[model samples]
Target chain A: MSGVSEHVVIVGAGQGGLQAAMSLRTEGFTGRISLIGEEPGLPYQRPPLSKAYLKTGAADALTLRPAAFFEKHDITLVTGTRVDSIVRDTGHVLLGSKTLGYDHLILATGTRNLRPPIDGLEHALDLRTLEDAKRLRKELDRPRTCAVIGAGFIGLEFAAVARALGHKVTVAEAAQRPMARAVSSPIAARFAEMHLQMGTRLCFGQAVKEVDETGIHLPDGEKIDADLILLAAGVRPNVELAQAAGLPCDNGIVTDAQLQTADPAISALGDCAVFPDPRTGRLVRLESVQAATDHARTIAKRITHGTATPYAAVPWFWSDQSDLKLQIAGLAFPEDDCIECENGSVLRFDGDALTAAETINNPKVHMKARKILALQAPPGRDTLKRAGYDLTLI
Target chain B: MVKVTYIAHDGTETTLDGAEGDSVMATAISAGLDGIVGECGGSMMCATCHCYVDDAWSDRTGPRKDGEDDMLDCAADDVKDTSRLSCQIKLTAELDGLVVHLPSSQL
Candidate 1:
């Protein structure tokens, strides 16, 4: 089980960090695994924070693993601790007064919610972690008006819940359509309608000029009164630690397809890694659970078995907005053309090559799309059309 | 603690104490039992935690929700009549001795 040094220190004990530790053990890497997290409790999932956890308020369900799991897997989980710096030459990480050496280091620092430039931003709330969700849930308990600053998945998901809880909800997006960054315009249009149908107000092409305790002010000089304001604008990767260590940082920690940094002994994954997409050869950073766990598994395999195969897993993502679950397979670009399939799933193609597929409330189509994208040669428009848009045919 | 037994494809039965609030998938995952991937962390977005609820406890475990049923169709293994996404089934004190069979694979 021993390859090089015995200790592997992982920074950021979120989804990817925890998966790296768990996958290392499952891959038979019997080394000393130290998973350090800034959060004070067991590693938990973030997707539910904006989805079921908001409605159910079940904090335990968000936990990825319990304390017993760390003991059983021999994973040294250092909660409520942050790694200050990494010394590449000495292969050590400094955590406040303590310094721990590592045979290899993994950076799964993930990302933090980005707060847009607006006056009095302190009045806005966040829904990034369990703590944020708990606070937002408390705000939802009472009959209050909510103003979400973004129309991305998090913002829309929160808007849907806030509406369901009898709270007046208003989602304001700077773009013409909601979730324009992720989904196709057509799909975003459908979601916009769904929110409108649910008694939630949707404001497009509007930017927040300022935020006060009462509510948010639009650039058009319109004031919307809101008791709770949620800032779900977006997120930026936590790459300060890697940057301080002299590692290249783009939108995330730059890594090769093998997910290894310039320093071979160090690797990065999850929301914090900008790796080469084997399909499109584009440097992409994903924030989905699928990407995080898959990246962790790939890195674990390389560290344990020395199998340095380029990561080619087809990226998939899902967002639950009320009863409609939006699922996507593959990566879509802004210029990619979208085709509406018979099963109500939209397939995105970059010229001749299929880039991504988006589906709402259609898991079968989404699953088929994932399987198709995972292939060496994904089906193009002609093949997809000839197959009657049935993914099983190809 | 509610006792639950997860039978793997190889007929390896691993029984563990499950807390009342956590899902069966979470309990199995915490125990590090094989065959239950739980890729989506009980969101029903991924069918990696697909399992076959024993007929004896199927009624108590309740029926699969629409989302869970659709996800089971995507399970890597063969989807059976008793196939269920373990994540949707919350562990309860009443269902103390729940027994569910894990599929052959959960890629």
Candidate 2:
């Protein structure tokens, strides 16, 4: 067994950061946990911000735990505070006037909404944080025509909620199809059709050149009129702290399979960390609750339980758009082959290997895919074809 | 307020007060209770809040909803005849004295 840490300092107090603190205590760590977040109030989950919270306006439902949970769990939660810098040689993190020393430092800074270069971009609202969601939620009090900048998960989810609330919505995505980076072609096609049927205007391959009071101006000199605009284009990982601290940074902070940085004392997780994918051995940075929580569990175990296991949790994601619940199990690259099964489920294969499974309104198949993909030797395309591509049978 | 008793897999019982509109899983989560992860936060997407309603309350609770049983297949614990996603069960005056037995794990 390895040694236990005396004090674990987690920055960015979001879902992943809080999870590390919680998991450390759950793993029987007697160390001091300091969870510092840049945002005020309690840390909450982001997934519901686009779906349930948008529809019902239930803000309480998004909080991961109550305020008393920190005290009860013996966790020191610092809100509305930012870690200015990390003094690597001295194992200290600067928070304005104070210096906090930590035996182990966990970076869960997550990502910020990507604001592309467009004139009058401040007019577009964001749905990334609780504050952003609260602002957008109040704006949703009255029906207003909304033009979403991207057709990714957040963009479409927002479009669905806005349309369901009887608001006219238009989605402008530069990509030819929605969710091009994350899903299979068939899955993207189905969502495109669903948005069209919802009476929402979907403008694919349309690049916005400007965002003024009148709405967005397309590169083709066409314009879409809308009173409200949402910037759901995507996100840029918050790697400035890590990069400034002399940590390797690319698309995200580069970490090992164990999620530890080159400094050994520091580790990163969630949307900001690009680690090796256990299945494909490719560097990937996933922006999902699964990655955040799983990475937290892995890091916590490594620090408290003295387990040096690599992070290998199966990546699962869900998005509730209108009445369709799309769930994806495992990771699929952009160039992977997609085979839409007869039963409405789509399977993604990389060459002969089954890489991911996409299921719409089918939770059982999604769970089954997660189970099958966790195996040491996931089935090949021929084996899946023989099994009729049914995850249950396999 | 309704009185709900949660029995852990190890047979430890803890009773808590649940508001009429709150869910069984939400109450447990709010109280920071163990044995119920509630990962998806009560969306029918995840089945981490699986529980077995007492036999006395099973009939009143009724069978699993249309797609609930399918979601339960993802539960980390075994699914039984009395198995239900606690999120799907909302507390009411009639369920005041409800008791739920949590599985050993909700990983």
Candidate 3:
């Protein structure tokens, strides 16, 4: 604690940034913490935007903290403020005409929705931010027909909500199954069935060619009429700022296992930072609330305790679609093979070693997966099979 | 703001003013209290904000909703008759001074 200066300036006041500020204070760091956010309000949670907020439209409930909490914690929260550049030479960040110095800088810029190259793309809306969600909610108010371009979590979640609200919803996905990139095939198929049962149409392996004011046109010369269109294809990290600042960025702002950039003074986390996975050693970028908050806590400990511990928290993610709550603990790569347990839980393996477990409405297995992955020696395929994939016995 | 008392498992009580609309878990977390994590940020996805409504105040807190009732089974600590995920319990003027005991741990 005595080794550094007084101020810790954080860019991107998303979940990770706010958690970093809180963790710094909780760790007994009496430094001047300045949390800069581009959005014009208190930092709020993003996961609910696609699920509960869409159904309830309670925007205020998403707020992570009240304005009074920041003031009481002595944390300076600058809303609607964008940090233009990082003046590394001066150890400061440029906010237009003004500059703020930092003893250490944390970048949690997060990500933006990936806008695909579809004609009349302007007709589509996003659900990444509060503003985006508000606009999407407005569209849901009318007796509307929705065309969701992606079968990912956001698109599917929105489709489910729309279906629940008695709206005609059609989800067009280029992939074979919903959430295929995140969940295993069987799990994704199960969710696809859930959406289908709820009367949401799913167009699989169909690339949307264009989006007009009326609806979306598939590449197969077929068109679906929709009053509202949502583009939840995917997201790209906001790495331009870090790249402009001369930090190495691959899929995201590349950092070491400890989340430290090439420059020792700077660190990055959340959807924006690609760090080495403690289990697989693969450079991975996670966009979950769990990853963001965990990375923040790890960085805070290193800053406060002055101990250089590598970031190693098990990554977890959750997606709520209709009544099915899908939870996955540990990181699963595209190449990892998946095994369906007797209890219908999908256990992913990077070769023989258990990498991740995907559970449908099974929190116990998901929790056990997290605990197992956090261990020094996680169970291998043999051990898992011997225990009948119960995880508890292992 | 609605007044609420959060009693830690060790019997450490911290009373704070929770906004009229915010949940009991959010209030405890916003105050930087140790017991509740609220990891999912009131999403009800993670049961990290589990707390036991004091028997005296349990009736006022109402019954647990469907999602919350099922999620409590996954709570880090043992579930009780009055146990609830604080995220589901929104603070209201009528429930001012409501007491909820925090579990030993919220994963």
Candidate 4:
């Protein structure tokens, strides 16, 4: 380990995987970087798959990096290939039948959409990958009713686009409100109104008992006819390889502050890695581009510059639905107290400390919240209240 | 044509002539405003183009959509009565003198 190791192997060529490769080189590590993914073609951004890409069908805009960038960076991108196993003792990863050795291994396998146990699930379209998005986009070409199973970001986003395309859309949420797990009840209710105003049907607190060609059957026996069904429930980490290889895993592959697994030779990132949250010190998994890229940069710095600083990037996320843009800075638990400003900004607090800030179409506040959270001594609720909750003074 | 004024966080003001039906976000971006990233390209996906409408002209802007109001809930700064997603504010004859204030952060 005196000289920089020459070979680095990264699994999962999504946002984090590709960023790891690029950041490794940017950090001046002249190593043999290999990026592998099970998905076909080059790595692409998944965020747009549920929004713009679905509406415009612009497949080319979804790519994360052009193929030429990888070749120029000396990164070996092994697309359409999956890593079967990791042998920590040998410092090698097995892909199909071939085993490739590496000085350091990175797991950026990301996550897959979770499909609950429901009949005729095959009829439900998924918006996780490019292929799934493409298929769903093709479905939008025809005039048909759409039934979205979940009211999360992706589900609501797709529903908005579908409704804009003049397709009848109905959103079914098992929770009391849309995006109940992610945003506050007030925010969820507001979006409920938006969706309803757009002519998209909202069905809350209804569990889907079954999915059939005709439509979905709710627990109360109400059936909604739909030609297209989207399963936007949520996602699960792709930790099978790590679990099979004897790596510690929970909801996602567990990693330390440095994103390294229990085995020092292996590391994980993106939606696949579950690390401790700096704010609450709770183990959490994030599914945003900001987290993935930030994690990659942290890992790259540790590997190349020997910087062992813990991963403490402030988390933020955004979602687009019709005429509204929702941006969240920081993470708030379900029980966090929310204060609504006169301007409609919601400040979420865990005790006296601000846990997160939720803003719609207001980037200034979103950015301020991120900065405030990153500060050494953020303004407390009292300070914020005294300042008229300006956040600029903070 | 609709006239719009954008006031930066530092109190710098820039005026632009916007076509009718263009979103305030699009008008600002087209006018080369340094702020307003519009990351989601006006789809309301990213709250990068947030702004605060002037109190006098706030009534000219339409009420925020449900999704827009929900997004405003998680903004970094405290939401105010004048806060609005610039993208959702379209240029119209009635909004000729519409003025919006920029927030401190879009990061």
Candidate 5:
């Protein structure tokens, strides 16, 4: 395949899609690169849809790459066009009645907010795309109370911002703790306390039965009135295109360690792709800039340089709520034992082996934990203690 | 204002006055303290401002939650008992004269 005619067509022009195009050029691939996205404008990051972009209304900052970068890299970016289907037999993609052929197809469609079947959900707003953030920001201009559905990162982040802006915010979560699926219970409890201290009301362990014009109604028949309702419950992977193309689909588009789908010509990455974890060997789908960008780089190496190394980059994520910044170095399961260090760092261990480390506003230790985990033989507790708990010695 | 001391990896100590409600990361960054990048603007999304809180003052710092604990797993250096994300630590009067050691790298 080296030196042969290469034309790469990447679907979904978000962070991962843009990165794949950029990485291809960075790796010296001079072939034609076409990026197709359902959203309008250039590829942008979704992370800021709930943070600074929301507060400052800075949509420009969310751009993954400037429009000039695409021209400079000789990449064609097709925005505001939906890919109707992928014809595997013809090795082409159908975009709104037009068919474009490709040698390799990369799926970076990402995920969409899951809209559960709740009454009066039409009144509920979302915070996923840049436009959505802008709409929500405009809605926030008024002195209105908001009922935020879910206690996940996005929900809590929005709640914090709303409260800081002097708007009354109430968060309802079906789970007992905030971010229960993603973080440990202790962390969730601490976040709950922080939200409470910030004057954001929290309603946990109660499923929302409906969302009316007034507010949200819980399963227990309690109704909380509010002017706005923001749903940040969860996201569903964008796998319909792959599934329609007759490709294997799971919770996300199933990909191997190299991020290639079951079919050799197709590959997937970012929130839409589920690949094996380097540390745990479990299939996981991550919706972070790190994962999407790293996945793009890996795919680029494979396509341009012919490097077949599996995607083994360490996975990390962060979330901001109020003054607190939560940095995570690795993926951890609920079964992982949470050990509290003297300095307030939580070390998650699978038995004696450290699987992940969670740090709050502590970057130094977080970096150390990542390096330590990367080691062939990580220092044991006794060795770590002998060094006065200093990771640099290791 | 609370006084906080940041000890770098090279053993250089820089002292800074932290605002009452300012996070330790923000205080250190505002003080122009070396080794605190604070990427993601203290959102806890990036581990660029990782530090090692002194064991003696651990009680004042409280404990880390699971989300933070999970984030430390990707830090650039070795993990230790004193590991902490500086952004989560607020500079209150109770944390006066707090000290945090810097890591070698954040990459």
Candidate 6:
């Protein structure tokens, strides 16, 4: 609690874990930093796995830091090692019979693909980790019919790539529109149109009943012949380790504004952290690189500099489908009002206040929207409407 | 192999070797050079990989890739006329000794 927190142990060395290790050094903390990951390699970026890596099959592009870099930073890199449990009272984590002591612990366990109760669901592939992506790429070697369940970001991104690779892709979604939870109706409609034009069959309002040797079947008794079955329905946070340690677990590992868990010695971040939305004060778990890195920075600063500032970085995410780049700045609720912009962008408002902005093939507006949303008081819907929803003018 | 010299904002220099087809950003990143973040992993989504091509080698790096300038607006530092996303600048035999200046920070 005085100088620098000594011996910081970070669990789940993906984006957030690696970032915390690096950030602690950047913040001038010369403590023992150990990053533990279940994966066998150095931490890599997950965003490109469903996009570029699937196409180019370049694994190096996904790696965040090389092996030598870890040595240079003095951060202990442990891969293919799992921490079996967390001993909160003893300030140590248990890995089988071995125990690692820590002045502070960061949980970045992230999430795993949700496996529904569909018969033969084990036959479907996942796209969560680098290993999963590599497997998906191997399946792409041949021209095959692919059945992608769920119409979220991963499913659609994979569908676009499979369709572009000359593979027959049929996307089945239970919702009426694609990406219904993330984007508004207008943007979702546009994406649906884009994928349809590329010859990817879109089956809306259809739930996959089962996955067998013949492919996935709808409850209506429609069977699609798919050689490759992909399950990108969504993900559930990996909270078992924390939950077993007596930490509260809801939709995710519950954390306060500073990303600190119930025990001050422990913290959570990234896909596994359920923190309050900086703007809306609603508990949420976000799965994005921005959230992962920002949360890591905040936690590192607290450990090193002892800064008590709350974690409040603006939330932003992007999905690339073929030639289209869809970027969303800030968060919007399902009940928010949607307004179309002149430059083909879309804005969401919770009453008079601006909630989020969505753009396609427009990073400029997305950047501007992120800056605007980060303000102490973001522009309201009335102000945006007065400016004709032109972010540049504001 | 092509060699690259990356000068940090505070005059720290890091020289690293890159494969013929590797991007300059990929080269610096693989070496853990402090300046370039490449948060998007060379996907061109985030401009955290922003770097300035040395004045002498600006023309050789040539124009920015399509949509590169637009993404630069979100860069941590101000964009320079020689601004180029390091990921977009691929290493080649002809340009073996490329010098790129890194910004103060990338977030």
lDDT of each structure? 0.89, 0.90, 0.89, 0.84, 0.83, 0.91
Model 6 lDDT tens row, A176-259? 999999999999999999999999999999889999876999988899999999999999999999999999989999999999
Model 2 bad stretches (over 4 Å) = none
Better of 4 and 5 by lDDT: 4
What is every candidate's C-alpha DockQ against the true complex, given to 2 decimals? 0.53, 0.61, 0.32, 0.06, 0.08, 0.70
lDDT of 5 at B24: 86
- Clashing pairs for model 3 are none
Whole-model lDDT, model 5: 0.83
Q: Which stretches of candidate 1 lie over 4 Å from their true place?
A: A1-3, B9-11, B17-22, B30-34, B55-70, B73-81, B90-96
Share of the reference A-B contacts seen in candidate 3: 0.19
Write model 3 residue lDDT over A320-348, tens digit each, in one string. Answer: 88888898888888889988988888998
List the candidate 4 regions with Cα displacement exceeding 4 Å.
A1-3, B1-107
Q: Name model 5 segments beyond 4 Å from true.
A: A1-5, A380-393, B1-107
Cα RMSD (angstroms) for every candidate in the order listed = 2.2, 1.4, 2.9, 8.3, 9.3, 1.3
Better of 1 and 4 by DockQ: 1
lDDT of 5 by residue, A166-250 (tens): 9999999999899987877777777899999999999998889999899999988899999999999899999999999988888
lDDT score at residue A228, model 1, on the 0-100 scale: 94
**DockQ of candidate 3 (2 decimals):** 0.32
Model 2 reproduced share of reference interface contacts: 0.45
TM-score of chain B of each: 0.96, 0.97, 0.96, 0.93, 0.95, 0.97
Highest lDDT model number: 6
Q: Is candidate 3 or candidate 4 better by TM-score?
A: 3
Candidate 6 or 3, higher DockQ = 6
Error of 3 at A83 (Å): 0.6
Q: How far in Å is the alpha carbon of A262 misplaced in model 1?
A: 1.0
Range of the 10 consecutive residues with the lowest summed lDDT in candidate 3 chain A: A1-10
Q: What is the interface RMSD of candidate 3, in Å?
A: 3.8
Instruction: For residues A14-106, write the lDDT of model 2, one tens digit per residue.
Output: 889988998898899998999999998898888999988888877887788888889999999999999999999999999999999999999
The prediction achieving the highest DockQ against the true structure is: 6
For residues B1-107, write the lDDT of model 4, one tens digit per residue. Answer: 99899989999999989998878987876554745755445655456688888988887796886567655765656678888888888888998878889998664
Per-residue C-alpha lDDT of model 1 across residues B42-78, encoded as one tens digit per residue: 7667888989999999999988887676677678899
